[model samples]
Target: MKLSPTYRMPLKRRREGKTNYKKRLALLKSGKPRLVVRKSLRYIRAQIVEFDPKGDKTIVGVLSKELKKYGWNYSFKNLPAAYLTGLLVGKKALERGIKEAVLDIGLHRATKGAKVFVVAKGAIDAGLKVPLGEGILPSEERIRGEHIANYLEKFKNIKEDFEKIKQKILGEMNG
Candidate 1:
């Protein structure tokens, strides 16, 4: 009896559920840098990456934890933190001469007004051109940490802190 030929195995990242080749191929086809946003339980990270024949090269990268340098003292995985990280990465990318990028939310669901989109909105606010549809961003109030402020008494100062950190990032970017 003839047996079928040995089946090929998927790439390690694909088998481990870390990479999606189809989506990645589409993003690469756009011929723009990728704004890669990834989140964990306690942190968020944003990077501007360019495709290379040998491997991907990161143009700029920022972690939510880096917000501490800008005086952010809240949860690093929250919406506001994601935005700040995005903004930071965006500004850094701009400084590196990258003006636009395509969003690459790997394996993340495309939820409207979600943290990922909030990051995209922040990048946009930082003057990075990323193509997004209408109404994809969270409302301004949410991005400002007003929701957290309204949810708890101790967070009453979150909005003020958010504004301060935002200004600091922008100020440092310009100066």
Candidate 2:
């Protein structure tokens, strides 16, 4: 018995679990830039990306580490840092005249109040119009870093630091 040799291979990205073509297609169909938020164990990054035939162009990219420029002195991967990064990206996007975008979390699960959503909340606060469902963002206390502050003695002032950094980001962007 001879077996057929007409097997088709899947896309490389799919095999590598990187890109979800179906999701990408849906997002592209909306005709809006994508606010892509991704997180690693030690960092969070957000980008305003526009789809292109050749490749995706990142209009604005912000990393949690960039928060240091705004006076953030805590963990870069924390919830507050994610929010600040989002704010920075949103401001940058607005400066480039991108008024609206859609959230693209990629293959990450849509966990309620996750750091990714915190980033989205921050972007929303920064005047970028990214459509997000209600109740997906974290609570005010969490976003303010009160929870982290209360969790450790050394982090007692995290909430205050968060506010100061947040103000600095907004002020610089507005000015």
Candidate 3:
């Protein structure tokens, strides 16, 4: 260990590259539940969480892997799966009486039409009042997996799969 008075000790998570204290502070100050969205190489996950002095409490959570239960046959890490996972999380949050939330994208870059925003879009459509910019979110058609479906046209079997899944997601959101 480098023992020097000039050396400042960083927090454990900060050293581990897991937590961003600055961003977390800002989200906590919003006084709204946070819609935490995360994605891996193979799956996406979304959670509606509340801040607690002791620890963050998850109110509702959904994973793209859960899409299999709804008959999703595509990769769980795709854009459509991210949207559906967000929709599922939003529906559950609403059922728990959570009407609004601020998005917590963590260390992810905020790119235009990123998967995080797609999840936010799904949550918005599910009736959660999360603030979003028109320019950042993907188009309505894209959220319905049109972009994906178009790209998979040659593979007839899976070409329409996402559209069907989007319909099922919408149906679940409605009833």
Query: Per-residue lDDT tens digits of candidate 1, residues 1-175?
Result: 8587678889999999999999999999999999999989999989999999999998898889999988898999998998888889888988999999999999999988888888888898898999998677778898999999999999999999998999999898899
Query: How far out, in Å, is residue 133 in model 2?
Result: 1.4
Assess the local accuracy of residue 34 in candidate 3 as a C-alpha lDDT between 0 and 100.
97
- Provide the overall lDDT of each model, using Cα atoms, as 2-decimal numbers: 0.91, 0.90, 0.85
TM-score of 1: 0.94
Off by over 4 Å in 3: 1-4, 154-160
Error of 3 at 140 (Å): 2.8
Candidate 1 regions off by >4 Å? 1-9
Is 1 or 3 the stronger prediction by TM-score? 1
lDDT of candidate 3 over 1-175, digit per residue (tens): 9577887799999999999999999999999999999989898989999999999999999989999998887778777778888888888888899999999999999998899998998888788999999899877766666666677765344536766766777787677
lDDT over C-alpha atoms for residue 123 of model 3:
88
Worst 10 residues of 2 by lDDT: 1-10
Give the root-mean-square deviation of each candidate in angstroms: 1.5, 1.5, 2.6
Name the best candidate (by lDDT): 1
TM-score of each: 0.94, 0.95, 0.89
Worst 10-residue lDDT window, candidate 1: 1-10
TM-score of 3: 0.89
